[model samples]
Target: MLKQTLQQKLLQKLSPQQIQFIKLLQVPTVSLDTRIKEELEENPALEDGSLANMNEPIEDYPDKDPDEQFNSEESSFDEEFSVDEYIQEDDYKDYGGNYNGDDDEERKEIPIAIQDSFFEKLQNQLDLLALSDKNYLIGQQIIGSLDDDGYLRRPIPSLVDDLSFSQNTFVEESEVEDMLKVIQEFDPPGIGARDLQECLLIQLKKKDQENPTIVLATRVVEDYLEEFTKKHYDKIEKQLGVNSEELKDIINEILKLNPKPGDSGAVAGKQLHVIPDFHISNNDGVLHLTLNGRNAPELRVSKSYQEMFEHYEKVEKSDKKMKEAVQFVKQKLDSAKWFIDAIKQRQQTLLKTMNAIMEYQYEYFLTGDDRVLKPMILKDIADRIDMDISTVSRVANSKYVQTEFGTFLLKSFFSEAIQTDSGEEVSNKEVKKILEECIANEDKRKPLADEKLTEILKDKGYSIARRTVAKYREAMNIPVARLRKEL
Candidate 1:
């Protein structure tokens, strides 16, 4: 039995050019230059040039049929690739366009900072210590064991084993501990603490040792740390027999101690620098939007590539080598043209989408006020621009816009709408902002719980539930009331 069936169906697929465009759309302005440079290096037919001489037309362009030149029967590169099938030989010439790169000029190189790392500082301090060779090695071992938070995460027994096997020098944990104690007394107050408690105590001990509050603060930390952390002022008062004023002073003293000592000195990770992709300026109640020029370079097909294609097209068809050369040149020209067109299209799409966003959040842009920001999502801008939601998301994910007030990621401007008790719509960002203010102004000794936070929002006409309030608080990295409590 032979079975042949025909059914009606619709299929969707992305072409190579479309895929490339999607990838480029998501790339932020900061990294777009690097990505362009990479393309330039990989594609020989591509180049970087300025648009100053764009009016000068490309001379002697080619008109070779890729299908006839690189026929399937005569495959040259072993891969079953049809150059004609991949290339669209339409009118790719820009009769009045120029290159995207600048002319040859002096380039300035940014100088790199040469500074000692955090570990280097520790090593230098260890050198100043008057220890014997064994003790020096132990000191080095201890310093290496410290985590980025400046705490010794590794146990002394592990260090003992590390010295025994790795360094071939057997040493007791006691010796290692003793050296660790000396290193703990280094410049950074809590550089060698084993835990958070130790880290805080180390910093507090470094303060005015004769201060009476210091002793009480140390007692609070050492004996009733749990109560102090939970803001159980009454419990602490009963246990330590301290009045409100005295407890307040003791708690204030504890608060002054550094929780993360390593952060006080050199940073442990690479710092990121943000480069905004768009600029929105407010002038006399008018808003102007401009995309970063780096993202919209004046790209055009390579003139030399066009000339090469023209030269190859003139060669006799009988010459096998010349025909292959013609196919190669045609393929390169097609690629360069497609790349240039894609870049141009990307610029146009970016402007269209960003302009729509600017108009959608016009009030917020003019006032630079988060409260004025309307509830907006990807689909809102996508519908306005007549594009897919994914496309708008790509533009928003990594892009930043600089305003009169400051720079912000485009994604930050998008938020879901929340209906108020008055049946009015407000952005979830507004609710979060209000929630943050309420927490900031609450009594730290008896921090407002999430239930109370929800009630407070309700009182302000925002009908938010306790769970939703908790979710919002957690999203902002704000701790629960118990964790937020301060003695």
Candidate 2:
């Protein structure tokens, strides 16, 4: 049913300026330069003026009282700074030219180049291998089929069929398997393995013989991977006829092996430079916080636009053209002013929220320790800052702060609370820390199970359930007790 009714519900909505400010507040220094360039491209009224030209004084201007320079009304939200009346059409017509001295400097361009993938590297190695054209092509096809983690996720039979159909040539599964074995023996050792066991075994087989740890690690990975991963040391000991000391030594050797060999070098070719959003330093006993100053560039309405607006206002004779010009100037100036004001507001909000967080987790920031991190969530910060939880969350996400310890993502400090046996609330981060420490210091031969871990945490005052322990363990990427077992 169509109905028209007058509804009166008090609701809050963010203005366009406020929204723009919030987005700008979250971006770090590294991204700010790109963002400013984007803004300059989008808004004709804004430009990156020369520093020398900016300092020059404006002549023939009506003077105002010095005390009225920063009046309360000037800062009030109700005061509408209309851009429509401030900017002229003629002013913006010539504004698009290369005004910032260097044409190349004005055009912001990010240098991006295509780089070689792991498959490409493997194919290059294949080219060096002495093989028939058919074998070389099959090897290249096999290399292309491998995943980023250096695993051949596709089955041998499936790949054979794919090659037979795609290449219009009959290829046997045996041929694919032989080529895979050769690829597996490539520099990374585990590149073409189909499964975890195969991957580990391939890496183990390539280790230097002089290292006893590598030999033992190879033996464990080959024979007792299933038992070792599940922390089933008792089963492994019974199967291999090894004692606790032998098992512990073997497990320690296995621990030294890289599970993901390809990952180490991946970042070197593909890490985006990060600029810290906030800076934290200790000033005496108090922790000082500063939002990255570069994120908020000094933006203002162009001086030329301001001058044109002033000129239009001063002319005694009023005409249609003059009125239109005044309207155009006013509109551009208002937009420019709104953008600059938004930038300032964004900085204030970010500082306010971050300051509250710094105060909330004072101990953690002061002492570079995760254990000191208090039980904090988005709601806690929201309540303190008198903002919505979503607002606080947006501020937390993708925002990083540089501390004396190291630069950390702001979201890392927030953790959900878990109730202890004694009814005291503790952060999940503390529990994870305890879990990590327990594993780090545990007897590898008889690594603790989830139930045992639960009991251990219970003994330490945390009354968490077995399932909760498993969840936390999984989050930390620690496998089951059987998988965690050595020997």
Candidate 3:
């Protein structure tokens, strides 16, 4: 048995409007339109249109208090209300949405590949065989099992089981293997290899086998693959009795093989362009920041919806159906206002957060130099913008910025601090940039090791450890010295 007790406590629960604002804030410029379209379809009160009033001046919509929170409970129809009391008089500014940017290509341009899907082409190629219905179904099942890389990774037993249960046909593994061998001969040279080695061999088998280089290359791939991948040229030479020049040609031929056969020969497919969430420009040493809002559709309360709400409110409070209609209209209106306000808050927060980041990385953005990036973290921007670190992270994580040098993810600019010998604070990005340069300029025959890299950084006044150097190298996708070596 439990005893009743009185207690005082505090709890924090996200309101629906607050949750919507958080979600909208985190959405990048690329997905804003889809999200807005979803809301438009879900709520008839919301519609895409010009939020900018041509008749009213901009000053008439006074800047809303960013700190103010939206509360849906406050809009309950059961409570006493007036026509002017519920109307929010939407405060969203159309920044390059429907009100502007009539020519910005709608924030993205994904070139649609006018061709068959990967599996479809493979299926078409499979159809040419004209196998029996059972064999064709088995082949179709096999084709469906292949991954995007064109590799059939599933075990033979698994395929047999799938076909037995799904196709109502029981077949042995040999039949499936025969069909696979037939489909592997399709176009693209390496359509049905099971692994990297198999993929390479399939491609090379399609090539001229009579060439001396081809013969030697097949030997290397088939026998000395381990040593060859490890760049153990000494062991390969000792075993194969080949000189450095001949070995180089052999290694080059094997290197040209496509490891992932599936990526190649897409008949037609979509290539999505990187739609930057923000744009930073250097105008004669001064920096300017602008949010890419071409995909942000304009949204507001429907005028007819508002009129319907008013007409229902004025008629009567006694009729049950009329009151229900009033309640429904009020709910829709509240939802519309909440979404509009959330969008406005999203814009404000994006601008606020990005402006803080731009100002924080002002020096680097000015000249597109990684060395000039100041040591910054989520907390720094959060403090600068008077927001939480989580909010700042949401802004930085999925966002991209277009710069003079190139498009960069916002997360790239943030790095931990490293104090120099001179007792001055510097960004780890600076050290990484220097580390990248050293590797880029080093001799590939004997690339610099992490210890040597650490010493070089220490010589330059960065007290980074060998482990830290390795971490940076790995972060930049650079391999170890042994892997970087070449003949």
Candidate 4:
């Protein structure tokens, strides 16, 4: 069934240069400096320097006369040729200048990159455990299994099977239990526990005094976890033989304990300063926007490399080695030019897209009110900016804007449209705002149920189902009516 056929089709595809431009467009000002440093390291033709000549306009280099250039295909020798001489390191040094002394005097301060992770912290603690080599390995394995929240969700039997199969080392369940008990005593007391009950109990057992509230909380977690989660206060009361006030006190104590103990120091360890990508301000009746300018340093192709390229172009063609060198220089110069051009295009695209977004959602920005936000999506922004939906999405993701009200992720302004009973279109975010207000004003003794909440919204002109109400409630981290009940 083999066949040969000639086919032709027209398609729109991004070149490597174009793709690089799009990626750069999505990177906000906060990350631009690091990105530029990475590029400088990768491409030798590109250099980090403060050259006055860098600001000069780039003109196309003239092509050399073909008669003088070497015909490489006609050559017979297999000897190697180098293009390094064409690129004079002196040119680079001149532009960057022999300012080592000047640099030292000026003291250009480069910010140190800080990096830490949850795993590294846990590994440090694992190192301190005074266990046998084999037991230490087991302890490390257990620590590795913990999730971001520091809970060990895996079962002992499953871990044992994995260890035996993967590492070819058979470990007994009893050995794992013994090692786990020691690990639970680590700085984050609840770490390496199998379940919520075990996690809470491990933390409580570490306390100096056996407080009555602590003991009661431990008992509830160990024995009445199911009832507690289900908000079955009547059943818990009968089972624990405690009054409502006593039970509330015990529940509050449990709430104060960290559910994910490993998340304590680990969270602060990796905390990054919030750098808003965009700043929004109001002047008179007009909204003003400015991209954060601190992190992004001005960049361009090193002037020395451009001069080297110009020098290579005037060389004679009969020298085959020299022609090859010229070709190499040309390629590097092209790459450098493409990168600088791409960066310029990236800045333009970002500014254009964001400007359109601000204008589109002007009401929200001006009033500093969520209710003023319209139902907007990626496609709406794409349409406004005359770009693709995917392009708009890339700009929105991982980008933040600072407003008079607060700092928010760029994507937070976008929400799906919900039709009200009066045939008016509103954002789901607006409905959530109303729901939050209703809850905040509601009497805690008899908090509204999902069905009742749905009816309340319907009365207020929003047509929503009980399930949708429940979904929104859960999204806001609000508990059910029973869970919200207080003494």
Candidate 5:
């Protein structure tokens, strides 16, 4: 049997404008222009630059009660609709006049120099090989199987299967393995190895035959790669019958080889350019922050679209086509207004959040010194700006600021507070700096261990734990003490 019951539940949903705001807030200065161009294409009512008075300040539209605007029926477009509801005389105030007239800035696009990609380089080498058409196709298939790190991650059987089904060619695993050997002999020295050990061995074996150290280096990679990686030099020396000095020479030869051979060749026009979103300038002792506006083009609602809506209002309400036209115009106009308002709001919010950040880390900005960076979090900036933490995070992500010293991601300034032995709270960044300096100055033959690093920091009044020091070291991409060892 089925029973019916009345249930009450509360639901929270984002409004269309709210959703639009969130998406816009996350777009960095480099990509904001692209987003704006997309909006312009989708909404014909939106226009670039000011069409009204240059001195007028542009005001946001849809100033009416939202409950009324959203709840109203489409039929009301014919009866109660008025163009004035969408556009007010005061809406065309600040036009951001600098973006207007012949003063519009033009940027030149420089042609990128073409270069071969990793796969193309591999294929070029494969082409030089004298093989039958079937073998040639098999070789091409092998090249396709290599990952970005220059390793053949796929199994040989899988390549054989791929050739059987996809290429309509039957081939044995032995033939694929044969061709794989040919590829592994390519210019990169380790272009098609199966693993790290093989990659190193391939490069080591490719060295000049006259070099005596190659034999020992090959043995170390082949027999005791684990010991070599763990820095157990004594064990490797005893097992290989090589003294400490001889082991050092062989180790030096191994270290000279490229681990990721595929990375050597340049790919055509694949370089990514980083554009910082904010600029910080220091004048004497004060810091000034300015948002990068190169990508954010000035925009406004099209005057023709506004006039068309007004014209539709004068048409007969009894005509269904005319009523439909009015509704369409109204929707486009509303979208244009919402989009424009969103862009302006995004600008204001970004400025507000970045200004708060610049003020909070004023000392660091003035000196470009990481040590002076105060302890701060998303909540702290959010509290200062009177905005949500998510808003601050959105600004921090994918955004970089160009300082007088260097460019930095906004998240770099934020750190957890660390309590010193003196009971004073400081940024964990300070502790990390001290730990880094200690590691840099340590003897490579017997590197400072994490326990010693912790003790050093403690002596300096940092009061950091070994585990925390390890975490910090790892965060900076520093290896453990054992891995840091060298001859």
Candidate 6:
């Protein structure tokens, strides 16, 4: 079975440069600076154009064209062409640009704030508590156990065991629970609750308990949580013996309580900052689209590095060491050139794709009208721009475009076509717009159901099913009729 045979088959593969370009193409305007900074730090031959030599005049030097110098078969580094003695730093190898799609999800990274994290803030609060060393440590453990939504998810017995094994500070369940209660009263009314009911009650108890509304709200949250959540107003009224108007005030009071106190700005969670990848403007009835300048950073080959390479190339009549040095320099120069080229291509591709989308959805962009949006998919833009669907998708993911209406995700513009009674195809965005209008204007006492909404769409000439209406409603984050009921 050791026989060998020649084989022939057609195959396709992306070159290193192509792979680099593809990755750079997908990075949104938000992280482009970080990616470039990484490239600058890694390759000595690459540098920020802002810091590059600008006073020097351009001259036709022999090493002026790095692409040609890089590709020419003048010299190459092989095993024999080693220069271990001259170079002191770590040996440079082939470069593989940062990402394999950056990651499968392409989620935007939130900028890390210098301020202490949520847990740290709680720890600071714990520092103020007057307790013994052991009690303080127990309090620290409880504060650490709180989740981002601000609930103590871990059980008391579990914390007791954790302290016993990890900290060697064995304590009973009751002791741990006492410390938890003490910390829960620190700040943000519901800091230490174990469940939704406890959280709401903690906030309610912090309010004016003497108020009839607060008293009724507590009763509702404690006894009628299920009915309240399901909008069974009738059941709640009959059980509590309260009129509809009285119950309405109590519901309003309960609604004011913070369901997730941990997410409150005073405690934890950094504020979200959205950096748009593109900006579109409608001026004099004409739309102009432009990519974010940050996306196209001005990068150039390091002049000093190029000069060093030229110096090594000039001392001709040299040995293997000199040639090896030249090869190393050439490799870096090549990477620097490729990275700059990829950046430019990424910029071009982004503009191309966005332009195609703008033209495709011109009416909507012109007036900020969802009803005018056309049925568009990734493939439509891909075909127009002569690119792959995945490429279009990469551009769309987690990316925002600033427009007259507001900053919106690019994926929001794309929707499947639905047929009208006249056989005219329309974007599902139009149907959603109508559904939103219907629900927004409907009487909260008798909210329209999905079936009724479907009939309304049908009457408006959109042929849609009840399930389809429900799906659209869910997609829009609109609650059902029963949940939407006020009293």
How do these models rank on lDDT, best leading? 6, 5, 3, 1, 4, 2
Error of 2 at 339 (Å): 2.3
List TM-scores for all candidates, in order: 0.83, 0.72, 0.86, 0.77, 0.87, 0.84
lDDT of each: 0.77, 0.72, 0.79, 0.74, 0.79, 0.80
Instruction: Compute the lDDT for candidate 1.
Output: 0.77
lDDT of 6: 0.80
Error of 3 at 52 (Å): 9.1
Tens digit per residue, CA lDDT, model 4, 323-385: 998777766666677667666666556667789889989999999888878999998988777
Q: Ten consecutive residues with minimal summed lDDT in candidate 2?
A: 60-69
lDDT of 5 at 226: 91
Measured by TM-score, how close is model 3 to the native structure?
0.86
lDDT of 5: 0.79
lDDT of candidate model 3 versus the reference: 0.79
For candidate 1, report its TM-score: 0.83
Q: Candidate 2 at 107: error in angstroms?
A: 21
Off by over 4 Å in 4: 1-3, 47-186, 206-211, 294-296
- Lowest lDDT sum, 10 consecutive residues, model 5, at 92-101
Model 5 per-residue lDDT tens digits across residues 15-130: 45555566777776666666665677678898877444545476753322111224434222333333344334213222211221123358544567777888998899888888
Worst 10 residues of 3 by lDDT: 56-65
Ranking by TM-score: 5, 3, 6, 1, 4, 2
lDDT of 3 by residue, 374-471 (tens): 99999999878777788888878878999999999889889999999999999998999999999999999899999999999999999978999999
> Candidate 6's residue-wise lDDT over 403-462, tens digit each?
988999898999999999999999999999999999999999999999999899989999
**Which residue pairs of candidate 6 clash?**
none
Worst 10 residues of 6 by lDDT: 60-69
